[model samples]
Target: MKIAVVAANGKVARKVITEAIKRGHDVTAFGRHKENNTDASKYVIKDILDLKKEDLEGFDVVVDAFGTWASEAMHLHTVTSQHLADLLEHTNTRLLIVGGAGSLYTNKEHTETVASGPDFPHDWLPVANAMADSLNALRKRNDVHWTYLSPAANFVADGEATGKYAFAGEELTLNKNNESTISYADYASAMLDVIENGQHDKERISVYAD
Candidate 1:
């Protein structure tokens, strides 16, 4: 499959690009700052917001890996997402967002989210809200085919890829150790697997290590 990853310079996005290339997929990196994945089929240095419809043509999937750690710019998540969705609306191409765990439901009833739960960290609320808002915006639109993959509560960066993972719908998941966590590599693998499986459509799924 042909894949394009926005904000491909991010730690998580870099892993996604590398894993996609390693899995024999044609991968392209689009971002403004850096080109860390030399293995990509092409690297385009452009702000995701500035990406026109022509820039997104001919890709089976566009992965929204855009992220911001600063509190002030968190709204960029929604802005960039809307931009991509607007461009790809009613097209055959799928837009898969690199989502956040905060929006994942904490209960089977789907009333609560991770960020709303008591144990969630206080400092992570800003970005979590941003992520949730982005997903919410996508939900209100039916024009584009999109999937949101939320990593487990503990999104490990330097952890190993066990080549094993499990999936769930909306609800947060915890592994055998009773921990909600997954390494960046395994999360990337799970996402690519979702892309290859062609199962999810306009849905949000959570991934955790096995």
Candidate 2:
């Protein structure tokens, strides 16, 4: 499969690209900044909103790994997503968003999101809200085949892949120890699994440690 990753320089996006490349897929990396070193099969230096339809054509899947911690840049999550949807409308390319855990349901009853609960950290609220907004924007679109993959509540970096994970939809998942966590490597593995298997379409799915 031909894959394009937006914000390809990101920590998670880099891992996703690496995983895709390891799977023998043709991968193209898109980033807003110029990088001196990259391992992508192809690279594009352009803002997500600046991308034209021609820029994204021929890819089997487009991963929206675009993310920001700055409060001002948070809006990029939603706006860029809208642009991607418009650009890919009526095309066969699928849009898979690297989503957030904030909006995920904290309970099986779906009464509350992690972001709405008292446990959510106030410092990261802006980014979480932006992710929620991005998901909402994607949910409203009908012309594009979109899937949102939210990470575990305790998603972390540099942990072992183990090539194992548990999947869920909307609701937050917990391990046997009642904790929600997944390493970046395993998260990338799950993303590639979804991409290759085509198991999810027009839905939001999440994963955590098994």
Candidate 3:
């Protein structure tokens, strides 16, 4: 498969790009920063917001790993989502987004979301809300093929990658130990699985440690 990963400088995205290449997929990385000794066949160093439709033509999928912690720049999450959606509208390529857990439902009835939970970090509200807004926007678009993959509540940057994972629906997923957790590496592997299977299109999926 031919894949393009945006924001490849990020921790999670770097892992995705590397794993895709290991699997012998044609991979191109797009990001603002230059990377040394990257495994991707091509690296396009440009601000993601500046990417035009012409620049992203002819790919199987575009994995959007765009994220930000800056409070004033949080709105860019939705902005970037809209831009990419518009660019990829009705195209052959699918848009796979790296999403947040804050928007995942906490109850079977779907009355509340993880953001409403008391344990959610206050400092994370900006980015969480921004990501939720982008997801909500995607839910309304029928022109683009898209998928939003949300990590567990305890998403770890450098957690152990046991090479195992499990999937869940809209509700926040917890394991037999009653914990919501996933490693960045595991998430990357699961993401590629999703891409390869050609399932879960136009839906939001969750992943947690198995």
Could you tell me the lDDT of residue 179 within candidate 3?
90
| Model 1: per-residue Cα lDDT over 19-70, one tens digit each | 8888899988998876555457689989998999999899999999988879
Question: What TM-score number comes out for model 2?
Answer: 0.97
Q: After superposition, how far is residue 87 of candidate 2 from its true place, in Å?
A: 0.7
The CA lDDT at 123 in model 3 is 88
Per-residue lDDT tens digits for candidate 2, residues 1-210, read 999999889989999999999999999999989881457969989988889999999999999998889877888899989899999998889999999999999877888999999978999889999999999988888899999999999989889889879889899989899999999999999999999988778899999998
Model 1, stretches more than 4 Å misplaced? 34-38
TM-score to true structure, per model: 0.96, 0.97, 0.97
lDDT of 2 at 52: 97
